[model samples]
Target: MTLSTQERTGPGDQAATGVVAIEATRLEKSFGNAAVLRGLDMKVRDGEVVAIFGANGAGKTTLLRILATLTRPDHGTVSIYGNDLAREAERARLSLGAVLHSPMLYGDMTVEENLKFFGRMFRVPGLSARVLEIADRMGLTPRLDQRVRELSHGYRKRAALARALLHRPRVLLLDEAETGLDEPARQVLDSVIAEHRAAGHAVVMTTHSVERGIAASDRVLVLAGGRFALDEPSSSVTLTDVTRFYIEPEPGDA
Candidate 1:
């Protein structure tokens, strides 16, 4: 059942308007002889947060990479904010912000430098002030001059997030974004997500933590065998339910 506006949680009001922000159909991918994604499909609407949970090697990262335009699907179609990824890739990317497993930062550059570089690439107006604003928001103000390689793993992740948000893209794709964050950092992350949703943006995050995933999303999906085995509103499922569904072996698993 669709939750009414009053019944909805986590900034879903704009999401209820039915504006599709990211759409993927028949996505497939493979490496060598092992097929990772098998005809997967997904849709995320503006102001919505969708969490995809899966075991390691369940193709979660691969799927996010494809959606982020970092990797191409063997055969599939992806559209972001009405821009076709294949034909309008540059335009499509203008609306996407992604934090992948790699952090996607220049290790030798300071945090501020990294943000400024990306901001320039996006042709952000008022780049200097925008860098300061995002850095402060991400708790990287104190580390602005610190080289990415000199920071701790968590701080590096924060820097990557800062870069991702610098341009205020319409869709944010996070691949295991909470993995290295501490409690305080996580709280900041939550606030950032809330602000993003409030702006009618879309967020698609992949994670292995069922509790975190469900808590941070309006919808929850379990990726297994390259397909969503379970897709339900976050409010409809419990940790136990997701855990049970997740542990069940796939059809051909011995």
Candidate 2:
């Protein structure tokens, strides 16, 4: 589907109209004969939050990477905001904000400089104001002049997140977002997720903390063997259930 730039609505406007923010079907990936994702399928609607839970090497990061258009799937179709990710990568990128394992920030640059750079890259209007807004929201305003390499790990993560939100992306892809966050930082992350959902943006995250993941999401998906072993509404699953699934193999695993 080749949509003209004029036909595209702003990310926020698109979400309010209930558009599909992300769609993936029969996704498959492999590296040197080792299959990481096997026929995975997922859809995240605007105003929804989907959390994917998986163990190490469960292809969680790989899945996020593909969705963010950083990596291509061996077999599958992915669309962001109705644009084909593989074919219209540039267009799709305009609607995406991703925070993967790497902070994706310039270590030598100041926090404010990093945001300004990304804002310019995304062509975000009112770049200075937007950067300050996001920096304040992420609690990085006070340290805006500090070099990223000099900040603590938690602060660096915050800077990364601020950069992602600077353009008000329609879709957010987070990979273990809470990895180095402290309690307060986690609260800020939660608040950001809540705000995005309230504004009709979609979020897809991969996390190991069942409680935290499920708590922030509308749906929970357990990825095992490169496929969804369990997919259900977050309200229907408990922490105990997730723990059990992780601790005890669910029959038929070597």
Q: Evaluated with TM-score, which candidate comes out highest? A: 1
Supply the global lDDT for candidate 1. 0.83
- Angstrom error of the Cα, residue 118, model 1: value is 1.0
Candidate 1 lDDT over residue span 1-254, tens digit each: 22222233343566767578888888888876677788878878899998888776778888888888889889989899888888888998989999888788999999989999999999999999999999999999999998999999889989989988999899999988888899898888888888887788899998878898898889887777778777778888788766665654353431
Q: Look at candidate 2 and tell me the lDDT of residue 95.
A: 93
Residue 9 lDDT (model 1): 35
lDDT of 2 by residue, 20-120 (tens): 78888899998766788888877677887888887777788989999999899999999998899878999999999998887999999999999999999
Candidate 1 global TM-score? 0.91
C-alpha TM-score for every candidate: 0.91, 0.89
Runs with alpha carbons beyond 4 Å of true place in candidate 2: 1-17, 247-254
C-alpha lDDT of candidate 2 relative to the true structure: 0.83
